[model samples]
Structures are given as C-alpha cells and as structure tokens.
Target: MTPDEYAAALDAERSARNDRARYVVCEEHGAHALMRRNGSGQAWGVARHVSQETAELAAAFLNRLKEDEA
Candidate 1:
C-alpha cells in the first residue's frame, strides 16, 4: 500500500481509540509514524514496513523452532 493510505489508516485507528491522540506520518519510513499524547498517557505507534508474506513466513518458522525446542 502507498504511504499515504497506510498513514491514513493508522491515524483513523488511533483517533478511534482517542480523539486527542496526535499522529504524524514518518517521511523517512513510509510505514512508520510518530505518535504521542498530550497528557501522562501512553505514547505509541507502529512500524509496518514488513510485507505480510514475510511476516507469515517468519511466524511459521518461529513456531517450528519453538516446537523443536519443546
């Protein structure tokens, strides 16, 4: 997905949880963001550069390794 589309989705998700939350799209990383809150609340965002295919593959391999260790 394009950076703008991903950023929009992120913003929507954050805003849904808290309207006061602040979100800014990271220009250097298309899939990342800088998020914060005004008060003593949690500061959080996402790093989403990895493709779904890679994530799935990594999860599968990690599960297999865990099984072997057990």
Candidate 2:
C-alpha cells in the first residue's frame, strides 16, 4: 500500500472504532495506531513507511494487534 492506501485504512478504522488513543508512525515498524480500552491497549499496523510491498503485511499484523487487545 502507498501512503494514500494507508491513510484510507486509518480513516476507516477510526470511523469504525472510537476507542483509539493514539497513532504512532515508526521508522522501523511503519505506521502503527494504538487503541486503548478499559485501561488495556492494542495496536494496528498500517503501511510500512508508505511502501506498497509491506503495506498489506503491516496491516495484517495490526489486525492481530487489535485481536490481542480483545
């Protein structure tokens, strides 16, 4: 995914959930958004620095992060 794709996913997730507390974009890990609930936390991965090759993978990892929070 490119930067545009990452941005779109972020928008979608934000619209769907209202529990997110922060968004972190890491050079090493790409775009990561954090969600907190009941004092607990979760993270969702976006694209890897706007790169298409790693975007989907990062997104998948992020989805797992959300599940872990659950």
Candidate 3:
C-alpha cells in the first residue's frame, strides 16, 4: 500500500483502540459503572449512575456522541 494509506490505517487502528466504552457490574455491591475513553484517551469511570433517569441520560449521551463509526 502507499505510505499515506498505511499511515491512515495505523491511525484508524489507534483511534479504534482509544474510543470505546463498556459496562460492568459489581456483584457484591450491586453497583454499575460506565467506563469510557476520554478525549485524552484515558480510560476512566464516567459515573456510577444511581438512578434510572441518570442511566438513560448517559445512554443518550453515548448515542449522541456519533464518533464516525465505520
């Protein structure tokens, strides 16, 4: 492949690794956490949404983010 195309592919791989999210449960505490990568590419807990409304809002926020999905 061309140099520019190879660089673009490498960047895509890095960005895909950096931009992602997931949810996890703490069985003992019965708690939920929203984990995501921030602009600085650091994985952090966005919040421990304690209420249904807050949880839905967080979901909406993620949906609205629209990060040029491939």
Clashing pairs in 2: 1-52, 45-62
Off by over 4 Å in 2: 1-50
Candidate 1 vs candidate 2, TM-score winner: 1
Least lDDT summed over 10 consecutive residues: which range in candidate 3?
A: 21-30
Model 3 misplaced stretches (Cα beyond 4 Å): 1-28, 37-44, 66-70
Better by lDDT, candidate 3 or 2: 3
- Each model's Cα RMSD: 16.3, 13.6, 6.0
Q: What global local distance difference test value does model 1 have?
A: 0.48
**Residue 30 error for model 3, in Å?**
3.5
Candidate 2 residue 45 Cα shift, in angstroms, is 11
- The digit string of per-residue lDDT tens for model 2 on 1-70 reads 9999999998777655534433344445444333223325555443345554354455456656765554
Tens-place lDDT digits, model 3, residues 4-68: 99999988985775455433222124545555544565666656766655665675667455443
Question: Which runs of model 1 end up more than 4 angstroms from their true locations?
Answer: 1-49
What is the alpha-carbon RMSD of candidate 2 to the true structure? 13.6
Worst 10 residues of 2 by lDDT: 30-39
Count of backbone clashes, every candidate in sequence: 0, 2, 0
lDDT of 2 at 49: 54
lDDT of 1 by residue, 1-70 (tens): 9999999998776555454443333333533433343335666543333455543444455445534443
